[model samples]
Target: MAETIDDKIKNYRTAPFDARFPNVNQTRNCYQNYLDFHRCNKALAAKDQDVSPCEWYHRVYKSLCPISWVQKWDEQIENGSFAGKI
Candidate 1:
């Protein structure tokens, strides 16, 4: 079955954050951490030319979902966070 945007986001949220960031334990705040990780992953993927997932997430986050709470995870990474390495 084809995965929906919600499925992708939900799956991402279920995964362990540290697994993606081996050097950082960003799971302190579940919701915030997940959203940040999701946005970062999306932006990084886009930067790497892997746009499908990023575009899907962006569409959903901008339309059906609301990602206003989490600050720009992509910007945080670019500003020297561990996210830049990923």
Candidate 2:
């Protein structure tokens, strides 16, 4: 049998293992997920598509990144100063 996106989402609990970030240090992974969430959301919204899929990135980052960092990055994004490309 095959799995669906809904199944994947429902099964998700926390950030999963990413081969790209093999080391114990997850700072890069956290930041990348944060950026991915916004970028995914933005792209879908721009296309008038459902943004639910972006929740995956949101959940991953929320589980990995610190609240303070998220807040600071959000502020920087709002002020057009965030260093990330998103």
Best prediction by TM-score: 2
Please give each candidate's TM-score: 0.28, 0.93
Cα lDDT, model 1, residue 3: 92
Question: Model 1, 71: alpha-carbon shift in Å?
Answer: 3.5
lDDT against the true structure, each candidate: 0.49, 0.95
Q: Write the per-residue lDDT of candidate 2 for residues 1-86, one digit (tens) a residue.
A: 79998899899898899999999999999999999999999999999999999999998999999999999999999999999997
Candidate 1: give the clashing pairs. none
RMSD to truth, every model: 8.2, 1.0
- Show model 1 residue runs off by greater than 4 Å: 1-53, 64-72, 82-86
Model 1: ten consecutive residues of lowest lDDT: 57-66
TM-score of 1: 0.28
What would the per-residue lDDT of candidate 1 be over residues 1-86, giving only the tens digit for each residue? 99987687656533333354455433334344445446667687768865455444343334322355335554574576634334
